[model samples]
Target: MNKVLISADHVITGPADRVITRGAVLVEGGSITAVGTAAELDTSVEPEVPRLACPGATLLPGLIDCHVHLAFDAGPDPLRAVAEADPGELATAMADRAEQMLAAGVTTVRDLGDRDALTVTLRDAIAAGTATGPRVLAATAPLTSHGGHCGFLGGEVTTDDEIRARIARNAEQGADLIKVMASGGALTPGGPRMWQPQFTRDQLRLIVDEAARYGLGVAAHAHGTDTIEHCVTAGVRTLEHCSWRTAEGIVYDPPTARRIVENDIAVCRCVSGDWRLFLEQMGPERAEAMAGVIRDMRKEGVRFIAGTDAGVPGARFGDYVGMLEFFSSLDFSHAEILDMATVHAAHALGLTDTGTIAPGMRADLIVVDGNPLESLDSLRAIRHVLTAGRPIGM
Candidate 1:
């Protein structure tokens, strides 16, 4: 462990807390040991500690992305890119993407899909200091029907034996969580329709229980109404892209929404930086309808976890601030949106130590040129990013 003193013009300790002016934090043993006015820390910290000062910047907890795909290229044809690349090359590319995320001030990410647990290897590499990347929580390969969405990644099961075996295998591979594609997805050509269910109610329950055997939470990639209902009943810890999709348009099922709120299942809406482009592609009327649904869900006590679905088509690892800005379309204030990315997302992912910049918290912090509480665009002016007290390579 190393010691470092970080001082900034302003520091945001939590989303709800008032900004601390002339703030300084002491990092020791990869954790924050002190947080207060820079003047107080100037005398309290040992003289041997190295100090880094940002005279006109705001310091805050590092951003967290709840859903990302380290395997895809974020290109016009992400599937083709993954399909065409060699295994070793794909892993190398994945490492590069993680570094991109790091440079963008994303300190933690939950990688929901990758081929052959490549993210697991990358996670370990980053942890061991052999690679430069964000702290990764990998889902390895998302569970799906034999030919369902993202089946090419190799998580496919049809029978009870196969399902249990795969879950066990994922646990063995050190997956932080289990990801199940509960419904069809646009990314998988020839797969079931987006509104179609991939698993029966009984099968969904089985997957949840099997993952629980390993003390792992299950995150479901659910889009349709019925499947979202199924996921809620099955106790999924997180719901990815719960758009309430149907054949004609988006549907807002009030009762299911209530259940999701009551059960406290965090929703990752999967909006990316190119949301405005998507809005144009989806048409204004549909976009308005979806926005209404999002607002209603928030009103019903559903706060979203920030996710870029990065590496999907048109979603880049470098524009996470853009994704948070998209939340404004749903009428969330800058403060509310900031919580969704930091403290709220940390809780959603069961990581309690890394979200807020407070004493005893992990030293995962970022400093930017302007106050993010006022304008999220300030996040784009990243001055520094540190994970576990070590400054990341920009």
Candidate 2:
């Protein structure tokens, strides 16, 4: 069946810089067959599956969130919350959050960490149509150095053999990608300083090599300078929270920044607007140091992507506008910020089929009530959203 959707106003086609005003998008099966002005198409004789007319909205490819933790609750103490919650309770909460994200116009999300592989199960349920939510890329477990950041998910590795075993286990469970905690983190109580390296170069090399053997990409949670160096050396495909700070002060690595640009390894900022609160708690000096490093990295031509680390503290699913606003503060254009959330993020997560609105693309799209081109705030007024040609209603 062929269906035509006449969008409200403009249709932003994504990184390709294509737009159709007073646009209409035609879908056949699960793929888009045409995109043009409504007046350009003669749809009278077609099968006419249905039309979702949004007279005041702009349609674009589904938004992609490259980082999230389905297992963690956005509580004052998320790590403690995860430990206290039972598996059943966590599953129910995660499912609810997924639906909230879809309702808010996020059609795809990459779950970077979860306890007990719940995300994998949730992904299957969404695909089977048993759940109402966004498409998911599940990282069964995030590999961590023994007692390193987020080590509670049972992915602490002390040796190369342990690393290999973990990757094998995730691949066997049908993981979309292998996530490695390469550095210390601020959220882990009494964890190593955020700038400290969690894994040795050889250790990282082993993880990357093993994951490559299974055709799985590695998403490393790295905040420290030394750890980011190890990640680049190990040839990691994606880096999360590349904050680049040391105990002493700002420690931006120019060579590592250049390598990231040259290698095209995607970097997820995962910086939520709530970072201000965390900064205040940690003190102004440390925040300033880290901000300096981030600014320098951006200036060094790093390939940055958007991720709110939602589910942690103040970051929540469907609150991605906070991320875009943060990027805007960093001097990224509105178009660049949207690209980081859409095409760049999709490419980072290996979802090439659903990032853009174009011919032969998967019909995963969202409509907003205003022009996102004019301002990022337009995303908040989502009129409708569709995943694979299936309309989803709140």
**Model number with the top TM-score:** 1
Q: Cα deviation of 150 in candidate 1 (Å)?
A: 0.7
Q: Note the Cα lDDT for every prediction shown.
A: 0.92, 0.83
How do all models score by TM-score?
0.97, 0.95
Candidate 2 residue 301 Cα shift, in angstroms, is 2.1
Q: What is the lDDT of residue 249 in candidate 2?
A: 60
Candidate 1 lDDT by residue in tens digits, 25-113: 99897899999999999999988899998998999999999999999999988878988899999999999999999999999999998
Query: Model 2, poorest ten-residue lDDT window?
Result: 41-50
- RMSD (CA, Å), each prediction: 1.2, 1.9
Give lDDT tens digits, candidate 2, residues 80-166: 888888888889999999988888888888898887789999999998889988999988878887777888887888888889999
Give the Å shift of residue 48 in candidate 2: 3.7
